[model samples]
Target chain A: MEYKVQVIVKPLDAIANPEGKAVERALAALSFDRVTKVRAGKVINFTLEADHPEKARSITEEICQKLLVNPVMEYSEIQISQSGN
Target chain B: MDPIIKIVTFPGTNCEYDVLKQLNFLGADAELIWHQESDLGSCSGIVLPGGFAHGDYLRPGAIARFSPIMEQVIKFAESGGPVIGICNGFQVLTECGLLPGALSKNDRMRFICKTVSCVVKTSGSVLTSAAVAGQTLHLPINHGEGNYVCDEETLKYLRENNLAVLTYTEDVNGSVEQIAGISNKAGNVVGLMPHPERATDPLLGSTDGQVLLRSFIEASK
Candidate 1:
């Protein structure tokens, strides 16, 4: 099975996001036109052999908790896909 | 009893020797302490040096804070023994819950390296005991995650209690209140982004940082 994880690393609610603010500024300057908010994040994709979809999700979740993202400022969204056999 | 300080070393820390050297030059016996050690029985104070611990894998100081030695550090601070965190160590202190708030990435989105002026907003901390209100000193700071952030109410409280130890003279980073360093309420623990030990010699063209180390010496006695 192959999995794709999109990690959304943003400042906490109480924290300020200057990176996002800068991107927003650039968006307005470059005239991307309708872009209102610009936030940056990371996307990770990997392949793993698993018994089932639930098992894959569990293992990936553990990786996310341990290393895939920093819970303090980032959150991870995982998607699993089966390869053509 | 002469005071002995221990400089805690995480896997990626580069400044333990710098801290040990400076403290030793100041007439204190300083030793390197490995991160896995649990007992802190031999020292009067502990220093967490600056560097990219755990290769800054997750976040600066995020994984480093959970090491076994930090358990002892928290206990030592709770017992009122002084702890000083510099640069990356400061990030660890905040991550380990020994200090309030966190060091976000620089608002400028760049790593800033230079001597910036810091004003002494509070003078009673062990780290700033030699300073006076409104006094300014030039210190070198090098880091991307040097922005200090706290909740609005907490920020107000820190200001009220004069816990802001070092504040930048101008907005170099997007740090709230331009905070360069801060101390806990009890004032026994301090964490700062600048490298004071790096500035403590005349050969370095700035000895204004000597007072900070001098203040630590005075506190241990």
Candidate 2:
């Protein structure tokens, strides 16, 4: 089976996101007053082949822990779904 | 035998020559090591010079940390070899978990390029062994992501272990506790955002960097 995985990496809440603040200021200057908060992160999409869904999730989680996300500064949310075989 | 210091160069690394010249002037054999080659040869020390490695994609040092040569670098650090990372090299060291904490974008989000004064916080670490604690050194820092961030536990550990080596007398960036540099638990590896090699020559305006570079060279020997 093939699984579609999306890993979203974001700076930890305790850490300041300067880029996000810049974007927020730009938007506010443009009169987007409704947008009160802004944060920035990256999304990584990949396909994983595994015999079981559990296996795919486990592998993706491992990848996130080891490489996709830096534990010191960022955290990641992994979403996995069954992909067409 | 003369100690050989190897400067590891990634594709975008531009500071190897500066480090090489400084090390050579200090009477050490300095060689440039390619990022793809794993062999460390007989070098006694390693210097990861500054630059945007692999275009700083995904984050500075995130991609470069996986370079084939890094395996040997990790081994070198583990074996108690003197390894120092300057600027982007420091980012790479943190990404590889050889050093603690992470360097984030500067608080104001501007690229900072200026000579700043740093207080030597620890005299026992490999990077500061030659400098007296509380003494100031002027070094140039050029980077966007120089603000260091870490968890509370990590911060406590650093203070308890005396791993924080260099600290800005004032806040240059919003680095936690103004930490400018730190070493691993073993003290064999160190990472800092300043360009010590650039300040080694008196013509560059300050020779304060020589104090630390001299310390590193002596440790390597």
Which regions of candidate 2 are displaced past 4 Å?
A: B1-3
Q: Candidate 2 residues B96-131, lDDT tens each?
A: 989988999999879999999999998887789999
- Please identify model 1 stretches exceeding 4 Å from their true place: A1-7, A13-36, A43-85, B1-3
Model 2: what TM-score for its first chain? 0.92
Across B1-221, the per-residue lDDT of candidate 1 in tens digits comes to: 45578899999999988888888888877789999998876778888999999998767888998899999999989899889999999999988888887788888678999989999888888899988879989999999989887777778889888899999999988899899999999888999999999998988767777888888767766
Best by lDDT: 2
The count of residue-pair clashes in candidate 2 stands at 0
Model 2, position B101, has a per-residue lDDT of: 87
Q: Model 2 misses residue B115 by how many Å? A: 1.0
* Weakest ten-residue segment in model 2 chain B by summed lDDT: B1-10
Which pairs, if any, clash in model 2? Answer: none
Against the true structure, whose TM-score is highest?
A: 2
> How good is the docking of model 1, as DockQ?
0.30
